[model samples]
Target: MIKHRFSAFLLSALLLSTGVMAAQPDNVIRPVRGTIDSVKGNAVTITTRQGEKLEVALTNNTKVNSVSEAKISDIKPDSFIGTAAVQQADGSLKALEVHVFDPSLRGSGEGFNPFESADGNVNTMTNGTVGKLVNSHGRTMTVKVKDQQKTVIVPDDVPVVLIAPGSRNLLQPGTKVVLHGAKDDKGQWVVRGISAGKDGLTPPM
Candidate 1:
């Protein structure tokens, strides 16, 4: 009996050390602080506030908040950022998610996008980046994180029925907005959500 109890105790300790606790979050979601030093295919060369310029991972849960769009013109040819983020790395951000908002979406009667998957109904995910919505035509409505006017395309397998429409048309031009999505292998974005705020939107740098 003593040996059996010792073995059980040891197993419990091992599980605890391995982080198998039921209380652990499914995945950690938080905001990170940094700037996009450069944008490549699907990745951004971020210069962290700590003065370290490293290539961080852009995940689906990543949310970029700024007064400016993420275009080359929106940022200075040579700019730095004081990135405020919640990440699980000791170095650059390898984003697992992103989130976006349209500052222009006030009182626009925004629409929503819808898609069906064999798995089941889709719901809001903490890991998604762009606004998954649709236009009045029942067409998927996606905008580039770098340029809201730039419509995004989606793969047939990827559902895009989350974002509410009027993101581009309803919101006033130059409306304050935030875009959410993560970089892909080609450095483009997979948006998950969007929003517009009365404040926190600034023009391009």
Candidate 2:
């Protein structure tokens, strides 16, 4: 009985040590999505779509980028796009941000999963092509990937942006922004990089 107890204790201690070792800081990136409430110098206050307010400090090294405007006509059949959207009660997808991906990145990270949308809810991400498009009453797009398809509603207000270079001056009040931040050892949320959209678009990635 004594030997058995000692062996069990040793096993528990080894497991605990391994867990602590596994938790080493590996440059993890946490996503921050919300609307720009205000900006004072290097500090930015954002009211998340969920109503939670977060303040992030921008350093001189923070990478900033923005999504330019695109028209509904820009979205064509077979054009690859990834939309962060919320499903409506009527079973239709309402787009928050529609990202037009270049042909080089086609079929990348293609699936539906819970996404942290700027509007605060468990949204869905559909990455594929415009298998079908209707624009008479309102715009609707069907995204097809492999054997699956997701129908997304694209309102005129939603911002569409192609991948391009951006600057920090784009971080203005009312601009939708998403950032990847990390908590420092002092428990401060340090923003590593920020991705902002022109007016209404949330960062697609």
How many steric clashes does model 1 contain? Answer: 62
Cα lDDT of model 1 by residue, 116-191, tens digit: 1112222212211234434333223232222222223222332121122332222333333333334456744444
RMSD, each candidate, Å?
A: 17.9, 8.7
* Best candidate, lDDT: 2
Candidate 2 local lDDT, 1-205, one digit each (tens): 9999999887767754642112223322226677898999988998865577778788888877667667767788899888888888987789987888667667755777667564445577778888889886457989886788888999887777774446778989999887776656765667777778876765655
Candidate 1 RMSD computed on C-alpha atoms after optimal superposition onto the true structure: 17.9
Q: Which residue runs does candidate 2 get wrong by more than 4 Å?
A: 1-30, 34-65, 165-176, 181-194, 198-205
